[model samples]
Target: MSPAFRLGGLELQRFARARLTRAALVAVVLIPLLYSGLYLWSFWNPQGNIGNIPVALVVLDDGDLGRELADNLIDRQIFAWKETDPADAEKGVQEGTYYGSLTIPADFTANLKSPSKDGPPQPAYLQVHVDQGKSYLFETIAKAVFAEVQATVGKSAISDYLDRIFVSFGKLHDSTLKAARGADQLADGAGDARSGAGRLQDGLGTARQGTAKLSDGLRTAGTGASTLAQGLGSAKKGADDLLSGAYKLHRGAGTLTQGLVTAKDGTSKLAAGAVKLDQGAAKLAAGNAEAFQQVDRFRPVINQLADQAVPFLRSHTGDIRQLAEFVNVAASFLADCLADLPARIQADRVKADKAYKALKTYLDTHPDLDPQLRTLLEAAEKAAKRLAELADWLDALVGEHLADLKQLERDALGVARLARQLANLAPRLAGLIDQARDKFNELDNGLAKLADGAAKLHQGTGEAVKGATKLDAGMTKLVDGASKLDTGLGALVAGANKLDIGLGKLTGGANKLNAGLGQLGQGAGSLDSG
Candidate 1:
């Protein structure tokens, strides 16, 4: 330290003796102070001077969000923010007119609005264009400023999106409350409906029971209708037989009337013959008396005459007896014919009337009977009435004339007995002959009256045949109608069975619907609680 100090003093004595060297030493010392002071002065308020840094702001977005971001950067004086297009901002950064440029893309606002929850998030970008070739500090400062701008945009966009999300949550909460209230009401309605469905199912069960009874009743009615149809068929057969009998009776009455007419003519001729015989008998008796008085003169002649006359008288008496027997037989035949004819007709009339009444009653009970069937019934009724009237007429006629027919038979027998007595007694012959002639005339009158009555009866019987024929056709139609009614009842029973089956299926569906509604109500209750 002593030698070094002695050498530094010699150098300082030399620098003191030279003016140039002294001046050089002072300059070197001042150069360090000046350089240090200038450096310190340059870095003193760099942050404060940040506003002087030229930067470009390019807002290409179509929405207000981009413009609002640009305006905020300018107001904050974070950089020398300039409103410019993308080309101008790029040109300014390259020409050193701007340190860097910040660009908001055309889709910035749109991209920010598209949340990740909606779909894939599209990130909004703020692009920074800096010229690091011009100055590294400028690139660094631009990057820092862009970072701040990014944070401001993120904060604003995120806050707005979060506000929107909160509002949506509020709306969702209100909608959930309304839905819960509606679900509660629906549950109540479903409960009421379930009860109603139960009641409906019970009612349907009752209806099914009633329908079963109805079907059974219809089946019973169908059986009864079948029986009725069978009865009608039998009735038709009876009617056909009645018509046949009426035709036969009509033909028989016509034959009997003609026979009575022939007998009446024969009786008149026999009466004339009997009168002539009586006159002859009186003459012969008178002649015999005279002959006896002259017997002595003409005894041989008297004997010859007496033998011929006796033979002739015997032959005439035999012929007269045969004629009287014929008259008695004819009267008996007439009496037998009238005896039961009225009774038979009366019985048939009653039967026909009964059948007609039954048809009418059936028609009255069944108002919906086919029109054609009704017409047939009406025709049958008319025919029955005609038959009844004819029966009544015959009954009245027989009642009025039956006694006269019996008296005619007795008188004919009496005439036959008188004729037999006349053959033995010639003296009584004339008186008996007069009585026989008178009886024959009375018998002839009775036979003529009977023939007239017989003609009327034949006419009445012909009409009865027509009426009976009509009744037969009508009964056949009635049988067919009854069969149709039975068939219709069977169809109705089948339809009722189908309806009962349908109701059972409907009840099952209602039960399923009630269970589904119960599940829906429970789910809604959980949602409301949440």
Candidate 2:
């Protein structure tokens, strides 16, 4: 302790001896207090330093928004705001009277509120002019306060923009919702329209098929009409020929009637003369020979007439049979054509209706089809309906003609049977005529033999009387045969006249049928075109 004390005392005395060292030590101790006091004296409280900053406010903007910002900056007490004009504010900053100056542009509010995504490039700013002559701390603090106020105004402007944007977005949302609803309605309408269009298309398809069928029917009808026209023409010509033949037959019948009367008179005279021959033997031989010659000559004429009549009847029978067969075949074909037409039309209509329903359902689900397409679809629907109607009408027409066709078929069958019977009887009638001719020849030969017997038996009167009686019986038979021939000829002429009248009616009916077919064809063509 003694040694340390002695060293400490010596060090103290040495420190005291060096005045400059002693002064330096005292200065070091006091300098800290001075520095602390100087700094602390200027800032007695933290709150006092806030408004102590001298800042100039150059209110260049005359609007309320800028004026409000100025008031807010001053109210914050961050700076000692000195309201001044722009010239004074700039002079104050340059003269170091202000730490910084804030200048608000005249169009501050307008600039602040103008919103752009790219940039509010020339944004409403607090134009700050900092005094370089001020302390770095003062300048830094002033600039920081200015930056905070600028940010505050910027935040306010951005907030206002955001509020307006939100409001606009709200209105847009309502408008968009309404537009969406309208679009939905439009889509629904379009769907309905598309469905209609599909239905129309299906109808059109059905119509097309119907028209095609109608066209085919028209063609067949036309062909049938043409054939009928030809048949009518042929029938007319045949009727004319028949009428002429009937007239000729009537004339021939009249001639045959006169000849029959003459033959009958001659036969009666021969019979009387034969009776007289019994009384006069020489006269009986002459009369028997003359009667034989007359009989032989009449036989040849009868054979010729029979041959002609048989051939003519056969030819007419064949023609009638052919006509009947043709009519029967054609009627059957026509019946087949009409039989299924109504069913086919109904089936097609059902298919078209089904297609329309399916298409309508599809369109209901998807309503965004083009408007022009919808219109076309509607038109198609109408066309299909019309086609269906046309088909129905055509079916009705066919039905109307069906009964007539059936009647025709019945008539044809009758004609065919009648023709067949006539055809069969024609040959037999000719054979009967040949038998009659042979009988006549035998009679002639017997008369000649009797005449020879009469001449030889001039002395035997009883045998001559028997021969005369046989000759008189033969003459009576000849008169009866001639009368029958005249009656048959008259009947033939009457039958021919009836046939001509029937053929004339048939031709007229055929002409009417042809006209009806033509009209039907025209209607079919019109329907097809439509």
Candidate 3:
């Protein structure tokens, strides 16, 4: 315990001595201070875009457009680009040797001509190498430089390829618009066509029904025509019978006219003969006047003799009685005949007067003919008076048989007049037959015209039915076209929706790029602060 106490005192004394004598603590403080001073001296004076900037241009592929793009970045004064070999270009970017580098694949020109292919595989590409976090001095400077480089290289590719894409897109847009408009138009037109077709179909159905009705009507008309033909046939038969009867009647009328002419000639001859007889009787009476006066004186003398003979013959009768008696008987018989003749003549006169009175009574009762009938009646009455005188004389002279025969002659003359009137009636009936035949012919011609008109109506109905069927077929085709137009319009709307989504994604990508650029600038700031 005594030795440990003595050693602790000595060790305390040595540690105190070493703290004053070591010298290495001063060296650690001064070295750190020197290094901090050197870093602050070189980095604290920050150079903006103008003083000094380092840029790396590593062209990894063989293309003039890539080299030109790097040169273009330099011309804008955004970076100081340095070209490195392609083999080292990517390695240099990763090791922080240069800011970035661009590489172009072969066939870049050919790929620019057309972007899409349906047949073959295509190979054309571009490569850009960049460090994730590099010095802000180079990275910040190269940002606008590399963007310009990208744009210049893209322009160097086949310009027609971009044009083709643009033109095709434009065509697609126009086609899509056309399809939309066409769909609307087709839908409207199809609807109208469908409605029209329905109406036309209904009209065609009605027309078919009407055709059926027309056929029925035609059948009925045919039946009516047949019946009318039968009626006309019967009428022709009846006409034949009537014509035969009329011909017979005409012949009878001709015979009657000839009979009337013969009768009139005989009556005229009889009248002339009666007038000559009357004149001869007048002349004989006038010329025999002296003889007639002598005869009158002789008649008195004869009457005296007859009286004288009557008395003398009665007294001297015995021998002369036989001869005188025969003479007396003959004279008495002659006197009896003379007395009965005068009485018979008186009765004939009375009968003639009664006939005239009856005829006058009949004429007065039937006097529809005025003054003309009166003139004819007066002439007839004078002729009748003469006939009555003649009848009286004849009745006194002729026997009863001859008087009855003369009365029959008057009845026969009346029968001839009645026959003449009947003959005239037959000619009038023949004229009626001619008029009836003409009327029947007109009826037959009118029925023929009606039959022709019905045939024309049937032909017109058939044409109308065929035209309606064609119209219905055309309208159905228009309705089908609308569906194709609607499908095209839907695809156009989908393309426009994709374009909007891409634009939104592009905006988000641009915001992320801005943040990355800020981080690179922060890493570069460490060269001064750290």
For candidate 3, write residues 77-181 as lDDT tens digits: 545666666657645654556545544433333333322322111223344444434443333333454455555545554333333211101001123333445
Q: In candidate 3, where is summed lDDT lowest over 10 consecutive residues?
A: 164-173
Steric clash pairs (candidate 2): 191-363, 191-367, 195-360, 199-356, 200-381
Q: Which stretches of candidate 2 lie over 4 Å from their true place?
A: 1-207, 280-475
List TM-scores for all candidates, in order: 0.25, 0.26, 0.21
List RMSD in Å for every model shown: 53.2, 66.7, 50.2
lDDT of each: 0.55, 0.59, 0.46
The numbered model that scores best in lDDT is 2
Q: Give the Å shift of residue 307 in candidate 3.
A: 99
Residues 15-114 of candidate 2: C-alpha lDDT, one tens digit per residue: 6686644664565455545545544553455345657778888786756777777777776766788999866875575456876666765656654454
| TM-score quality measure for candidate 3 | 0.21
Model 1 agreement with the true structure over 1-530: per-residue lDDT tens digits: 69999987786686567664455455545544554454455446646777788888888887777777777677777677888886687557655688667776565666557434312233354555555444424434644675667556556644454222210000001233344455555545654553344244346456656655655555555555555545554554554345335433433443344444455455555555555554555555455444444543444454455555555545576665566566556655655555556677678778877877787788789889789988998788778777777777777877788787567656755655554454346444445545555555555555555555555555555555555555545554544554444344334433433333233223323333444444544554443343
Question: Where does candidate 3 stray beyond 4 Å?
Answer: 1-54, 60-64, 74-77, 90-100, 104-113, 116-530
